[model samples]
Target: MPRQACKKGSHACDGVVRRNAEPIAYAHGFDWRPAYNCKQWFAEHSEQMTSDRGGMMKRYARPLRLLAITALSVFLGETLVMLLLPFLEPLPQHVKVLLDASLVTALVLPMLYYFLFRPMALYIGERDRTQKSLSKLSSAVEQTADAVVITGMDGVIEYVNPAFESYTGYTQVEALGQTPRILKSGKHNSQFYEALWKTILAGGVFRGELINKKKNGELFHAEHTITPLKDDSGSITHFVSVWKDITERRRAEEALQTFSQRVMDAQEAERRHIARELHDEMGQALTALSISLQTAEETAESPAAAEQLHQCLGFVERLLQQVRSLSLDLRPSMLDDLGLASALRWYVDSQGQRAGFIPQMELDSLKTRLPPELETAFFRIAQEAVTNVVRHAHARQVRVQLHRREQEMEMVISDDGCGFDAQGLQTRNARETSAGLLGMRERVLLLGGQIAIDSAPGRGTEIRVRVPVE
Candidate 1:
């Protein structure tokens, strides 16, 4: 064999390689058949011509791997152990000899891989897994329906999801590291935020509705919760806030309230118009007949005709009184003109006459007038409760009170009659109650008020209401 391939810088030699060439030979995935390399002049040399190759091997390892992969592209370019597969117990003589002759079996490299390379490889695999897990977590937060916000213990923004961006019209880049004060709508006072911070910082969850301002300076309602996140040792590390936009929900509630009020108002207006028509048209006709009957009676041909006209005249008077009472029942003109106090007093007196006694009344210092809608709600609620007491209470005595105190107005109706289990009313269907108690509750709630009916078997009923006053 010629020596040029292994020589230093000759025409036929790229460079002198005074190193063991077995690993390189294996890396190419095929024999190179180099002249005077490996076993020939390199092995026969008695002089020391070799140098250290560990650094070089490590440096060129990746490129050599790629080249090996390309060179053995035909089949899986794996180690002979892989090719040997399941034939591990008793190998063929030639294959066994080839294995024994390989550098892995003959040299110290395989032992070194166990001692040195395995830890590094395991570390890289674990790192790759962690990266993938983090990526998936980030994606899930971005795609989740609720807006997510992660803040440090000091309330500095650390992360926010895409939904939050859409909700507040603020991008992630704009939100990071900024305090949440940017989104404040000023609807909530400092005390509100202080309470929220105290709750969450104590490792408790804080939940409530708040008005939040968007990037465009428009305000919206957000229902949100903030929960403290703890480390393994139980120290609080961060706070995770989740937000749901509730502006549409609030709007829907207001719309329903407006619609309900309008429906009630329209019914009252229609009744009033019908009542006026009945009184004007029917009363005039009846009066004309009465006058004609008087004249006919004075000039009657027989006493039978005059007596019949007298009976008819009495019936007409009764009919007129009935129509007027019916008109008042539909909607009292006093309620519109004199406000809630007069209307309520009239209602209590009317109920008293039927109940056989007047209720113990207390109306001192009551606000004489309220907003029209609020007044209507209060009147209707009172009317319903009064009706319930009269029909169901079966008591001889009752009490009615209305007064204003501080920022609130309150009303209470109590009866001394045979009471019922008010709790059972909740279980009963609305239609079962002859009184419109459920409608009263709805009206009270729409006005941002509370109504409570308390009663027990053999104990008299009490309906108490409290509403904020402007």
Candidate 2:
């Protein structure tokens, strides 16, 4: 056969691999490949399979040999009887018959044990073992927490475990003859079911979340999986489905997300309030104080008094600058008066000056202002990304790019700094520990947007965000 391209997911590649791999002797034509330790397991078990085959052959030959030996013993016994017939001529016919009968019984007892009784005993022992194994498996299936349903290839329910009855609120009698559609909540369209069947019938497992109704017409969430069961001839005979109840977990997650969003909203409101207070109240007071001190310095009689007043004026001016900076950091008024583009330019420039890094910006001039909430969200996400870069990324430069389209907007922030493992931070625990990342993700999720962080150790980090404007 010609060599095929070794591209993953191609049928030609799979065929070539299967042909190149060592043959596995499977009794039921199953070709399962474990995700882990496949080669080591196959190598270790190949020798064991050979040894078992040899032992089976020996067991089969032993019974045949025993039968042959029994036949030979019977022949010898008959020959001995014939030879002793002359000697037993004087004996009574009844006594001779008795002796012949006793001799035949003695020879046949051992032969029957070796040829028939022994094999029957072994078969009975094996049958008991098999029954025990099946009993254990049945017990496990009945006691499991997840619902398990077995359906024939025609999609009729054949069996359902006790958990299935509990989850669906149906008795075994009620569920046995009915199809799985009996529990349908009508939340999923026919296309969903068609796709599920298409996957399993084609020998692929389908795993997803489902909304199913109970006997009382209560809808619930479930994590479901369907797998095809094949026969010895490699034909699909049935499908086994498992459903794990996830209603409580899903509700809890929704509740948490809602709570987080509310908290962020409150936080923004507080920040806006504080920024206004600092700018309108404290800023005006400080500026008036500086003006008064400057006038006092110019009108002072003594040189010493004038010098002291000058120093006080300088101190007041510095305090005013600090106040303005604080107010801007809390929430910039420019974001409200101006637009996202101008505000971003000001923030980036100010951050570059404060952090001593080169800031490069490519912002689109969105002539039309976006929704207030959307603009806030975009600015906050950008602020967070840049703040993270300044704090953790000891880089000399940072780049921010913004693009606006007819239907959507995109923003990308990249830093040429020492990066951390973005992949490892994908776990729930990791996200929980990093409040910055979690907040960013939650913000995007609330806006029905997507955020992607690409980073690797010793390279750089890039944060990309996209949100629909429609």
Candidates in order, TM-scores: namely 0.62, 0.73
Q: Residues 1-470, candidate 1, lDDT per residue (tens digit)?
A: 21233444433343343334322221110111222243444543422233235446777886676555444432332364566646754877787657645624434344445544675698799999999999998888889989998887667788998999999999999999886778888787756776776677568998899898999999999998888898644767788899899999999999998998788778767977887777778767867877886777778788898888778778877887787767676677788898888888888888788667557778754435688877777777777877877777777878888888788889998888788888987888878854487788877887788999898989898999999987
Reference-based lDDT, each prediction? 0.74, 0.82
Show the colliding residue pairs in model 2: none
Candidate with maximal lDDT:
2
Candidate No. with top TM-score:
2
Give the C-alpha miss distance for residue 311 in model 2, angstroms.
3.6
Which lDDT value does model 1 have at 435?
48
